[model samples]
Target: MRNNGAVHGAFRSAAMRFFSPRALAAPYVVWMAAFVVAPIVFVVIYAFTAGDGAFTVGNFAEMGRFVGVFARSFWLALISTAVCLALGYPAAYILARESGRVQRAAVVLIMLPMWMNFLLRTYAWMSILERNGLLNRLLGALGIAPLDIIYTPAAVVIGMVYNFLPFMVLPIYSVIAKIDRSLIEAAADLGAAPRAVFTRVIAPLSLPGVLSGVTMVFVPAVSTFVISKLLGGGKEILLGDLIEMQFRGAAYNPRLGSAISLVMMVIVIVFMYFMNRFGEGEEGVAIL
Candidate 1:
């Protein structure tokens, strides 16, 4: 009976370790609540309230302007994401396939820009793209008229693409590096064309990375104020600018800003949901 009791006690202890709530998780939960959930709750409450003393629907009623801002934000983010994918895929492929030393160098080169302040990077683009900037000087030397690239929508896109490209490439490289060479070789051995192998094997297997990169690029691009302000100028006001305007200006309308913020959050959630659903069934295919 003592032997049986000892065995039962050992099993119980093991089960408790597996099933009991982890102490480590408690800190993370508290942190999330403090930083994320608390702010969101505050935003939600303010969104329902009004600038005036009374509770009102005025903020929600003015949501049309917010919707327009949201649309512009979405389109710019989409364009930036497309550019990141177009540029990052090849760069990631090369980095992943390169030798260890070359890969390390490439990674360092890719991440070097991130060490600089984001605002400084945006300002650098502004300087380069400005009418009397280095680019125009080069153009003049070549007997060409200086083109206006700064303070335009195209410039905004370019700035966003440059800044976020690393975010896209690193995730993709991580996925591609883990892909097995033999799976790719098998596809080739089976008489599959290069295009066929990439589409059927590489594309599907690399999807998780692509999704991660897309989310990383898209979310920040949509909400970024610095790039829009620096590159787009005041002429191209994005949703972030509008939110800032409400908060900082004499309006001081927290309710309206909160409503706009909530709407932006919803849009992000919906976009991610659809993207995940689209990539769901074809996961775990050979990628190398």
Candidate 2:
């Protein structure tokens, strides 16, 4: 009887597969419909409707003034992504080449700050870079004049790089760690120098990770309003601030906000498409 009961239980468990995927996915689909899809639908509806109960194109037609702000946001994000790549590539390489224990420790250290609040980290930079802050005091001890580092476009970039550097490092390290050492050895056997091996082998192999890191840093950096608000101090206006103003500030136009948000989304999608294309090219070269 006990043996029969055990068999019955196993059969029931095996038969539960149908419920598992559907049961687990149903709530997520409902949640997405309620949150993500609903909000986007609302935005689209708002973008097309006018305040006077008419469907009009005026909201989108007035997008010309916001174009310069979007351009500034793109370039600023590009600069921040470049800075993250410059710093993260060598760091990732070192982490990937290290021993197992060292690699684990380094990864932990790199990811440790993510557990902290992002706002706290940004404010910490404020403490270091502000006038009469720790940095200036250190410079004072050296008999050097205090430098103005905060409340400028440079400060905004610094904050962005600090916030997004780990995003760049982890993906690159993941790709670098998976790289086969035999490829490097093969390049050397073929009379390729270290530089040649790195350019032809390591760089090509790591393209997917590089593309991921660039997108991670660039997209958020361009659309972030908080960093600019805290660091740029109203002197610099990015697309995020402009969209935010349409919703929350004196403008108070949800339709315009929706239009701006849609445009920004389109820009991000286009940028990612190009990055993916570049990644595919590198993959093709590596295959050959």
Candidate 3:
């Protein structure tokens, strides 16, 4: 009986080794360490030290020179995020209230354009928004004056809104779609008006998704260079553009680039922190 028990214990140990959670996670862990963790470590090293490999804080100090770029980046990203929230919330609400077939069709339509490369999409906007481009010509045919919108800050915002709108919609829609119909009905039974129900119940419940959508929109918007580059006509420089210039352009300083990147990371973290704080009071948000 003792020998049988010993054999059974050994067999169970072998099975556990093969089927444990850690064994399933091993591939993802290795991939993350090699790609994500390693790159972050290198960026930190490059950001803090000088050419001689001596520790220095000058890299961060150097970012102080481009205060305008940082400010502009934040401002544009904030505006773009606001626009996406305003547009996306209504669209998502409508879609979520629709039949399942309609919801799937709408989501697929929104996601189809994203299948193309980002550069190609931005370039396509350039063709449409250019001075003598399709948009201007159409306006001219309608007896309206051609507006010089391309290569402007407005152009940058338009690019951001067009590109990142889906990010906001998908999250909010997912949240709204899963909201218990019973809750909405209960609010109605309690003599709650449509506006009051939405404000007190629907809006508060969807706050998590709103925060997530904001983070998704704002982070990338704040760090974008490609949209500013093609749309701003290489004149309007945002934080990302400055960082890229440091590493790749005439300014060619990888240390400065890394420092700017680190600063940008901190800024994004702070923004998300505030967003999370705002949503923390919600005791009734469901992930589904």
Candidate 4:
């Protein structure tokens, strides 16, 4: 009887521990299972099945026709990520070296546009880039020719850089800001040149942030349909546009959409894995 009682007590204690408020992730796990996991499972099922629920590989085989679209998407996304990194890195480096007041003001200015509705911001850009828009009007006032920019790949890249630049800057700035001042001082004391101090110490220590920013920028830029539709004017049909068309546009092929999404998801996961491994290697080097 005592052994039975002890067993029951132990089981109850275990259950209580699992159910306790300290186990705060329990609800999150349940939510993820119902929403994220279940949706992914459905996507996988749809990707493999046909209209009549017959399994087929034709969906993937058909992807060969969209090679140009995939290439264009990756190219444009790469361009945007590169632009963001180029512009953001300098801004973040400068911002990190500024006074607290200047940093706060600069950060607010950088984030101001993000507070507006995304569509509204895009629309504003549309107007600004239009032939008779503010930018062209200013050029006209200066007796310069109006440049055609709207509905072009350049416009799409501009929109992407404007929207996602903050993502890159913030991560890099956060990492750079938290760097130990003592390490920098020590490097300088050891007669290291300014450039050498930056290259050997600050740059290496801040690589994880750069990787994070790249991931954040590249993933969304690669998969974005709206920027392509609104700015690219649907002339440059990208992978994102193709996937969206399958589900929402006249194509109405959910199976193909799911296949594209699944492929993109796997590619992104592999990319992230390499990025994380690279980050780990850099961290080890820094530690050494």
Score every model by TM-score. Answer: 0.87, 0.90, 0.92, 0.89
Q: What is the lDDT of residue 67 in candidate 1?
A: 69
lDDT tens readout by residue for model 3, 1-288:
999999999999999999898899999999999999998888899999999999999998977878988999999999999999999999999999999999999999988878989999999999999999999999999999999999999999999999999988988998889899999999989999999999989998888788788888999999999999999887979988898888786889999899889888987888778877778886543322
* The best candidate in terms of lDDT: 3
lDDT per residue for candidate 1 within 159-215, as digits (tens), equals 999999999999899898888989899999999898898888887788888888898
Of 1 and 4, the candidate ahead on lDDT is 4
Give the range of the ten consecutive residues with the poorest summed lDDT in model 3.
279-288
Best by TM-score: 3
Which residue pairs of candidate 4 clash?
none
Off by over 4 Å in 2: 1-18, 281-288
Assess each prediction's global lDDT (C-alpha) against the native. Answer: 0.87, 0.88, 0.90, 0.88
- Give me the runs in candidate 4 sitting further than 4 Å from their true place: 1-19, 282-288
- Predicted structure 4, TM vs. truth: 0.89
Model 4: ten consecutive residues of lowest lDDT = 279-288
Q: Model 1: what TM-score?
A: 0.87
